[model samples]
Target: MEPILSVEHLSVSFTRYRRGLSRAELSAIRDLSLTVEPGQVAAVAGESGSGKSLLAHAILHILPRNAKAGGSILYDGAPLTPDRAAALRGREISLIPQGITYLDPLLTVGAQLRRGRTDPDTRSRCRKVLERYGLGAETEGLYPFQLSGGMARRVLIAAAVLDSPRLIVADEPTPGLDVKSARRVLGHFRELAEQGAGVLFITHDLKLALSVADKLVVLREGRTVDELPAADFRRGQGLTHPYTRALWQAMPEHRLW
Candidate 1:
């Protein structure tokens, strides 16, 4: 099957002025590529500055003003231009942001979830979706300020999934939760993939990601070092890159840290 999302030979760089007005370009992502197929969970893993989040923004066409992009991002076999990304974003493609700050303090949870839709059915669906995330009906009235960190994150997840998007870009989504909660959140991502939606799960936590990812894209220094099945990391087999093997060995479960 054609991938629901394909990022090929993608690079992102920032234009900056150095001393004496000399221009300098800081490349944050270099020839990075990955794909997410329908009914699959693909993970991008590396330390901070590996450009995982930038890849997500690139797909959404939300890169910063000073940033330049190269190569292609295709969705369903066609080039995903900025106009297309904008139109599809929030409807067919959703972002589960890494930070809870993405939530608006002024808007109540229900309003944020509705995203300006006031239809009776939308309201009903919003309530049901929140409930699915272990949030109650009363959560609808709570603002971002009123929610705990974990609760706020759950609210973000609930809101992002409201559209039943075909593609989900989740950036470091499980940071603040307990192990059980994090596992539960990853479980939901798997559930979404099982329902035929493609998921791109970006994180620095290799261990947490392996719990749900179908394929693992190992990144290092802004480039893809290895792309392997999740089972490779599980069995410590089929990983060709040294960094990839090191990461697997460093997992706490391996006690080689």
Candidate 2:
């Protein structure tokens, strides 16, 4: 089966202006490539500046104006242009963004989850999704400010999967949650993958990635340093890249720091 999302030779650079008439280009992501197949969870793990979030924005066509991106992003074998991405976004492709600020402060949870549809079916699905994430039907009446950090995060996850998107891009989705909540969210991603959806789980937590991902792509200083099975990472095997090995060794279980 074809991969649902394929990013090949992806590069993103920002044009930075220094003094008058002086400018330079800074690359944030260089030559990054990965694939998320249906029924699979592929994760990209890196430190803060390693460009994991930038990859998600590039795939969603939400890059900044000063940023210039090169290379091809294919969705189901077709080039995913800006227009195509916008068209498919929310319906077929959904982003569980890194920040809880993605939720509109003015809209209620139900309103955002419904996405402007007031039909009975839409409302029912919205309630069901919220409940699945440990939220109650009464939670829908709450605003962004009314929610706790963990509640806000769950609201975002509930909204992302409400439409049953085919490709889910979750950037740091488990942050701000308790262990049980985090596990529930990750388990839901696996369940979605099992239902034939491709999931791109992006985060800085190597252990969390290993727990939920089938494939792991390690990034360092804007480049893909290693790509291997998460199983290999768990067992500390097949780690040829020095950076990847260092990351594995730094885990608490290994304690080789």
Candidate 3:
């Protein structure tokens, strides 16, 4: 099957300037290449500042204008240019950022879902999406401040999938939720993939990734270090890469009883 999204030899760099000094270029992602097939979840796992978020921003064309980007990103066999990229975001490729702060505090949850170019069937779809994530349609009338952490997270996810994009990017999607809620969210992701939507999950939670991801791509210090299938992870097969081994050791299951 053709890749739904592909990144080839992609590199992203930022320029930092100190007072009265020449700017220094720092690369956030280095020669990173990956593909997301239809109906699969590709989990990108790493420590903080490993450039996972930068990779996502680059793919979405939301990187800083001053930042230099190299190589190519293709979606549905077409090169992603700024104009076309903007059109694809939320319509073809949707993202749920690391935190639930993207929602407007003043807007009602129902209003935010409607803002996603939803049609007259908006109410029904929003309710269904919310319900799938363990929320009710009645919660839609409440403001962001009125909802609990898990509820807010579900609302943001609902907004991302409101239009049913072909690809979904979720960053730290299960943070701050109980294990049951986290499993519910991951189960929803599985359903999304079954419906033919490719998912790119960026997380530090190895256990969650092991349970939900079809494949794992481990990153360290802005570079791709290891790519492994979920089956290998479940069997406790030792990772060949040191960075991947460290990540495995850092999983909650390895730390807790």
- TM-score of every candidate: 0.95, 0.97, 0.90
How many clashing pairs per prediction, in order?
A: 0, 0, 0
lDDT of 2 at 107: 97
Computed on alpha carbons, the lDDT of every model, listed in order, comes to 0.90, 0.93, 0.84
Q: Which parts of model 3 have CA positions greater than 4 angstroms off?
A: 116-119, 249-257
Q: Tens digits of per-residue lDDT for model 2 on 44-132?
A: 99999899889999999998999999989999999999999999998899999999999999999989999889999999999899998
> Could you tell me which 10 consecutive residues in candidate 1 have the lowest summed lDDT?
248-257
Error of 2 at 94 (Å): 0.6
Count backbone clashes in candidate 2: 0
Ten residues in sequence with the least summed lDDT for candidate 2: 248-257
When sorted by lDDT, best at the front, the candidate numbers are 2, 1, 3
Q: Per-residue lDDT of 89-152 in model 3, one digit per residue for the tens? A: 8787999877788899989999888875456687788888888778877888999999998889
Query: Which structure among the candidates has the greatest TM-score?
Result: 2
Model 1 gets an lDDT of 0.90
What's the CA error at residue 95 for candidate 3, in Å? 0.4
